[model samples]
Target: MSTSSFALRLMDVHVSLAGHEVLHGIDLSLTAGRWSSIVGPNGAGKSTLLKAMAGLLPVTGSIFLFDQTLMAMDRKQRAQQLSWLGQNESASDDLRVWDVVMLGRMPHQDWLAAPSAKDHAVVETALQATGAWDWRERSLGQLSGGECQRVLLARAMAVQAQVMLMDEPLANLDPPHQVDWLEQVRCLTSQNTTVVSVLHEVGMALHADDLVVMQAGRVVHQGPCADAVTHRAVEAVFGKRIAIHALDGQWVAVPKF
Candidate 1:
């Protein structure tokens, strides 16, 4: 593959959490400027895998970001290379939405320095992109769950990093907002921003450029979304006693009672 087509490479990455092993020798290469989704049932290590890619967890193997070892870089340096949004992200209720979004600029900002005009511009653009601009002046506590989630997403997008790892971004979003997020992901991909997210929505995950199907602590399948064999692998990973079909152009995973 071309250099531009390969963004991050994970070689035998294994991670443990809370005294339990979660990821088991995971190996995958994520393409740059593309959208990749990881899907699995509970206890499948989906979040753990994402965190390992972001260097948030203690991993045994090497994770390379654009041909450079992520672990070899210092914390500040890695922060400039990768942006992350965890599943249970929480913001102080008293912080203004604008300020929270501006925090994304921290990696590029000097210690104790004030926000620059360019930073303000990026924050505004990110807010508008996530449809959270109207709530910019509001406090975090004033917004609902979905609204808060959008504001946090805007914060991550404002960072403008080349690679972004988000865990459960669709958590509090409604159906319309979920569609909006898909559009945003497409826009980011076009601009050469690689995006990888862990999702519980099977049908939505099927729409990604590539799918990583994890089961237990291992990645059972990783391939293009259009591969019919991959679809069967996905169904097998979930082990759902149901039919998987295409409904109105969207992949639907329906279960039978």
Candidate 2:
């Protein structure tokens, strides 16, 4: 694929935590305007890879956001180009929902500057999109686990970045809210945004446009989600304990007997 077609690229990427190398050499290219899910069994380093792509952790290889070297970009520039939603993120309990979402605008604002009108508009739209508008005045600590996740998602959406990296975004979300989250992701891709998520729910991960299957800290398969090969790879990584099936025109993973 042409470099221009990629939203993010990595070459020979390696990560280490606490004197232990977590990710091996990884080469990945994520197409722009597409949603890709990374899945693996426990200790497969899915989150570590995502963190590397986000530039949150030190990496030994090259990572580029579009054409720019990720580590070379200034903090503000990186923040404006890539938005991140972490798993089980903690926010101050006293922070109002609206204020928390507004924080997403920090990259676009001047130091100590008040929010511009456009920032307010974006935050409001994000909150409404996540169904958290009614809680705009409520504090973050007052919300349930699922509710907090929605708010954090809104905050990430409020950034309106070109690429979004989400780790376990569906955590704490019930089935209905999970469906809502899928819709929200679809809306993002419709606008040509690139979304990469690490999900533990195999069924939910299959909903993505493509799947990045990993095992033992290396990418074992990268292909369209509907492909039989991808399904086999997914099932393989999980020790064939799950089976992939097509149900009502959508793919789902079911437990193996």
Candidate 3:
């Protein structure tokens, strides 16, 4: 594939946390305009790998965003090209939901200048997309866990970045909201936005365009989600305790028991 066709690329990437390596020689290439879900059992280094891709952590090897070196980009340039939604993100409890989402536009704003009209429009659109617009005026402290997650999702969406990397984005969502999130992802991919997520829900991960399976800090498999080889790798990484099957023309994972 052409290098220009990749939204993100990593070469022999390695990350260490607290003096111990967590991600081992991760070489990944994420196609532009595709949704790629990363999956593995606990301690698989999924989050660490994601952080490295986002340039949030120090790494030993090369990472490229589009055709540019990730580390070489300035903070504002990186922010404009990539967005991140992390697990249990912390924002001030006193901040209104609208204000929180507006933070996403900072990278595009002039320092010390008020938000532009376009920023307001983008924030509103993101809030509506995540079903959080109704509570725009409410403070973060007033929302429940699931509600908070939606607001944070809106914040990430408001960035309108070319690439979005999310870690456990469905953390507190209900089944219906999870489906909604899936639809939102489809919409993003349709717009040619590259999405990478670390999903604990095997069934949900199967809905992605591609799957990256990791084991003990190493990537064991990467392929199209519908490929039987990908399913086998997923099951194998989980010790064959789960099985992937087709139901209603969609792949679903069920416990072996």
Query: Which portions of model 3 show Cα errors greater than 4 Å?
Result: none
- By TM-score, how accurate is candidate 2? 0.99
- Cα displacement (Å) at residue 31, model 3: 0.1
Per-model TM-score, in order, reads 0.96, 0.99, 0.99
Per-residue lDDT of 117-217 in model 3, one digit per residue for the tens? 99999999999999999999999999999999999999999999999999999999999999999999999999999999999999999999999999999
Off by over 4 Å in 2: none
Is candidate 1 or 3 superior in TM-score?
A: 3
Error of 2 at 101 (Å): 0.4
The whole-model lDDT of each prediction reads: 0.89, 0.96, 0.96
lDDT for each residue of candidate 2 in 112-166, tens digit (9 for 90 to 100): 9999999999999999999999999999999999999999999999999999999
- How high is the lDDT of residue 105 in model 2? 93
User: What does each candidate score in C-alpha RMSD?
Assistant: 1.3, 0.6, 0.6
* Root mean square deviation (Cα) for candidate 1: 1.3
